[model samples]
Target: MQKVEVSDRDWKHLLDLRDKVHVPGSPAGSNSNPCMSLYRPLAERTKPFVLAQVGQSLDGRVATPSGDARNVSGSDGIVHLHRCRALMDAVIVGVGTIISDNPSLSVRKVKGPNPIRVVIDCNGEIPADAKFLNDDGESVILIQADDVDRTINGTQAVKLPRRQSGLDVEDILGALRKLGLNSILVEGGRRTIARFLDAGVVDRLHVAVAPLIIGSGPNGICLPPVHSLSEAQRPKIDVYNIGTDVLFDCDFRHQYQQT
Candidate 1:
């Protein structure tokens, strides 16, 4: 891992570089660009951490009227998405997203060691044919609520019972921590991201805001209502523009203190 304390000027330069390469409505070229170069270094600095990466439309929608993947973001954004996968120690998503999208959740374009694939299946009911169950490049861990038969190939299944309203976020994080993963990336549909945020577990947030607007669809986050309006002020983000996409970089520690 590259070791260097990043200066404020370095952060500003990185943001400028991201803006130049993360062009909206354009296909990312084959060659490495300013965005990748800038992000690669910053990602290195965020070791033993967690980052929440998500994409949403201008109006805060992550899907189409009928839940189709339509115009979420251009190829440039997708390329950046892969960069997140390459940088983190592991990738996490809820079972609902796994069943709906059937994502292989691998780092394809960028050449780097693939992170461990994690599925938050509260009920140990992942379908036998899920791609992560068969992928060879990275190991898969299914976090569930019951003892599942460990006969599945290319996957390690573990059980962690739900606490209160949903799967215990603290337990899931503990398990990831036990696996020697210092950093984790939470890639999600909606409900999963919300759970992480609501549980006060997400350490950072990287929201890629697409230019298009989807009037009605699944929200990018489905957080439970805060006990009161005052309780909702837990996350205060520092925003940066990546071309048309806005990245909301937040540190939950500060938010927790403020709350």
Candidate 2:
């Protein structure tokens, strides 16, 4: 984390960075804004570039005990999330997020083409009228187990081998990559992000922390228990302050995960 805080003065530069996000030789290559730093590496990828994003409270709660996670992140954080979606080929979430948030998962906050909206529904739980599945000019993919036979109308289903954790992450990525969705965002509830992290498939992790603290609720991440701290992960991280929240851009590739 850099000690110097990024303020409103950097907002225009940040927006400029967002505009030319994936262009390798663009002006973003010469800039030092945290926005440019957060995404430049993952941009323009030929292979799979998986990024997991989460918006949580200070104490690391994604939602309250009552499941009220409506706006944990303020306006700025919300825009930042949308900016992330704009840069990716697709934005992914689990069925829980669909049932709870019913997010459109489109690039409404920024001026960019919308990415494919994907939902993981291993148990055939998502409804046909789910917001993500609705047509909004972008493609939508539903990932499920092969035996689940059911389909959510209008979505392209990609069934993979189901494991104890869920559908295989590698197969999911492979299937998505085959469709040219190389840059993926795992935007979700806790378990889905944890599953990807545990699978060692995530390349980067964007954790946007809002100012307020939720004393008790579901944690942002609930990974498998490790007896000792030595077994824990210590990825290289970069920090950015985008008004309402602090973004921790963690580089998991080559640190531990197989990117």
Separately for all candidates shown, the number of backbone clashes (residues 3 or more apart, or on different chains) is: 1, 0
CA-lDDT, candidates in order: 0.69, 0.79
Q: What stretches of model 1 exceed 4 Å from their correct place? A: 1-47, 147-151, 227-229, 256-259
Runs of candidate 2 with Cα error greater than 4 angstroms are 1-28, 135-137, 254-259
Q: Which residue pairs show collisions in model 2?
A: none
Deviation (Å) of 59 in candidate 2: 0.4
Query: What is the C-alpha lDDT profile of model 1 across 1-259, one tens digit per residue?
Result: 1112233444334443333334332222211443433354435543456778788888888888777864496555666677677767789999888787788889885555578999887766678888777666688888877655444566777677757675788788888888877668899968888878877777677777788888998888777767767666556565555554665656676765433
What's each prediction's TM-score?
Answer: 0.76, 0.87
Best by lDDT: 2
- Tens digits of lDDT, candidate 2, 164-226: 767888888899989978889999889999989999999899899999988998987889999
| Predicted structure 1: lDDT | 0.69
- Per-residue error (Å), model 1, residue 62: 0.7
Best by TM-score: 2
